[model samples]
Target: MESPRGRRQKRRKTFFLPLGTSDGSYKPRQRAGHARSRQTGICQVLKRPESATNTVKTITGRLKNARTNPSPKIECWIPEKNPSNTGLVILPGGGYGGLAEHEGKGYAEYFCRAGIACFVVSYRLGTQGFRHPAMLEDALSAICAVRSAAHDFSVNPGRVGIMGSSAGGHLAAHTLVAWGQYESDVPLRPDFGILCYPVIVSQGPHAHRGSIINLAGNDASPELLEDLSHEKHVTSRTPPCFIWHTWEDSGVPVENSLIFASALKKHGIPFELHIYQKGGHGMGLNAPFNWGAECLRWMSGITGHKTA
Candidate 1:
């Protein structure tokens, strides 16, 4: 793909490399466009190799029923100039049922312009009869995929981070707190996190009920709910986070951000919290706020790059 100014910016569609298997005998499947950079506008769909199915089961204890949805994949966006060594995996929010385009591609475009390599994850969703660990598995796989392919994307493996909006924020948080439970040769924890008006607690007056129901179902047990409530699981190991929420976001209450920030504080984790008094849910990069700019500054501190 090319920008309107006639600058070359290539966007590629590719499947994540299969993660390590139980026996540790899996070899990465090779493809013609595995790391090709081109100006072609047509997106070539790369089939998920069979080895990845084993990887899914290894990560989440079960594979997503293939009949319910297509396998999860990521859309790559590399900057046209001075690409930063930083890479970010973006998870878009749709209450665990759908993906918000603005939050996915829109955020990707914004960060790619600032020289960050971006991957927009089309992870498994709950509305498709999928549930908790399915989404969590995909999130972990994305982090591993990016770090494993850091050389191909011109990114520093240690600088890779995860960003999500709304329910996607919950997914990011879940992956952050729950990473220690999953074993992987590749690091599953993000170096940092950017959560925009995330759905935090799974059971509370402030919880996003639709997200909880879709993720855990009405018959979910209290133990599962407590585990999914990310705030309750934060520890010193959790990565530094950048969180922002609007006081007017009724869809997912601002308290979600508040309590999570409070948890991060309790653990003495480095973080930045921004509370805007305007905008509702799913505003993406459209709101008349400088949260994006502030995030760039924070990211600069993390990456030691002048992203602004």
Candidate 2:
């Protein structure tokens, strides 16, 4: 069944946000919000890929099915210093179903201020039905779109990176692992990967089955679960990754990070791994002088970009 909010978010045909002004929230936050909105508006919607997909309509009559909604809109923020340079594409984590405002909007400026253009993706989620590759399709399309328009956006075609947290992290891993699957295809390869408390183990005792279940649905079979588990698909080609996870994560086992890092190292892929002693999960950009500072420094080291 469709909830009200999900229905509203899936309405994609229109350009501008549906009528009525945004209900005011924390004003300082709103000012930050406005800057981010203006930045996203500069982004032009990219073309959908030629991949074939199959799907059915939702109860709300919108295209909630995976294959039907292949294309994702692209929004960018070109840095003043490197106006026409390629940079990171930030895929905000929303458990494979939604994009959170703080991660997708408020957080984009951090990248824009840095010297890279930010591609905040508005991908279709599983509100309609569980589907494999729906998220991947959207992500791959974003990568290709950015790379194709690298000159127009001032993006460094060869230096583009992709980062995400949690479910978004899982998608990033999958995109990396499946990089070579499409032969004779445009280079959808991301130069590097950043996974924060990523859920890579999808099955087994240490697996994060909820993420897979939520993505594949209640009737998800074991075979489907195994297929999506990034650990199962790791190969030598998986991009160098920088990742971190809290030891106290209750949602996903810390093993998810360990196993992924292990796979990355085993495959000879360059990677940096960190396990914070404290801090619970979903601490989105929550740095209180202790954990956040270290995390920022780690990101700077890996991406070669300075941090605050």
Candidate 3:
């Protein structure tokens, strides 16, 4: 498949690789609030090679899911300066069925250029027989892994945060709200959060059904749906957040970010929300109305680090 438009930026060192061709085909389902169908976008057949290895240069680590088919991997992109004070773990949104490489590498390189170390996580999806907890676990694990290895990557463990787009935003939000609730090998909570057009409500008017289905399956119970609806879980303890959405985003409704931001506001959590008049779903880090700089500036304000 050809790379998405605007992905041809000057490259940085990376261990992240494109997920190979799909054997299964995807078809778009027409439904209300469906945003974009799975068939029309990048959701292709799954055919990941078993021989893929982690990179030593960029601190790529495979969080093997021995119980599943597509093993989760963490691709780190450390800034050239090394020992940066802050870092980010990125979760690319693909409706929880597939990973979007553009969101992964493209966003990582964008942040890396700003002097913030980043790790793009390709986690196990529900289509591979995994479910909600697996994606959440992989996200938390990626944060822990980054924090544990902060010294090696020249990052401050205390300054690490998580960022995600669309469905991946749901995972990042879950991580922020429920970090200490789960058992993990290292520190679980991120210092802050950056969610771009996230899937927040699992069962509301703004709910993203495909993302919900991919994470919890088509027959998810009411109880499961309630549990995964992250807006209801926000508390004063949740980390500060930076959220943005496009007003014209037909895929993941802009209301997803609005409702989540409202929840954050209700809980009195520090946050910054941006709703741009243009740009639609899955734009990655494309230029012309890209909000990456604004996000980075907000990050710098919180972390007390100058933008690279």
Which candidate number has the best TM-score?
1
Decoy 2 TM-score against native: 0.72
True-structure RMSD, every candidate: 8.1, 12.6, 13.6
By TM-score: ranked, best first: 1, 3, 2
Model 1 over residues 1-308: C-alpha lDDT tens digits?
A: 43453322222444333222222122334334453332211133343333221011111112222223223578777664523478788999999989999999899889888878888888887788888777887887667666655555566777888999999999999877877776546566788999999999998799999999999888999999998899999999999999999999989999999999999999999999999999999999998887888999999888775662
The deviation in Å at residue 180 for candidate 2 is: 1.8
Q: For each predicted model, how many residue pairs clash, with residues at least 3 apart or on different chains?
A: 0, 5, 2
lDDT by residue (1-308, candidate 2, tens digit) is 76554342232222211111111111111111112222111233332222211111111111223254456765565554553243676777778767766665545666566555677776667765647767776776667656544544445566677877788788888888876654212366787887877878777787666667667777878787777888778887777888888888888778999998988878898887888877776666773324335544555654455542
lDDT of 1: 0.75
Writing each residue's lDDT as its tens digit, candidate 3 over 118-152 gives: 88888878788889787887777667566545554
Cα-based lDDT for every prediction: 0.75, 0.61, 0.72
Better of 1 and 2 by TM-score: 1
Clashing pairs in 3: 22-45, 83-154
Model 1 spans > 4 angstroms off? 1-71
Model 3 root mean square deviation, Cα atoms = 13.6
Candidate 3 or 1, higher lDDT: 1
Q: Candidates ranked by lDDT, best first?
A: 1, 3, 2
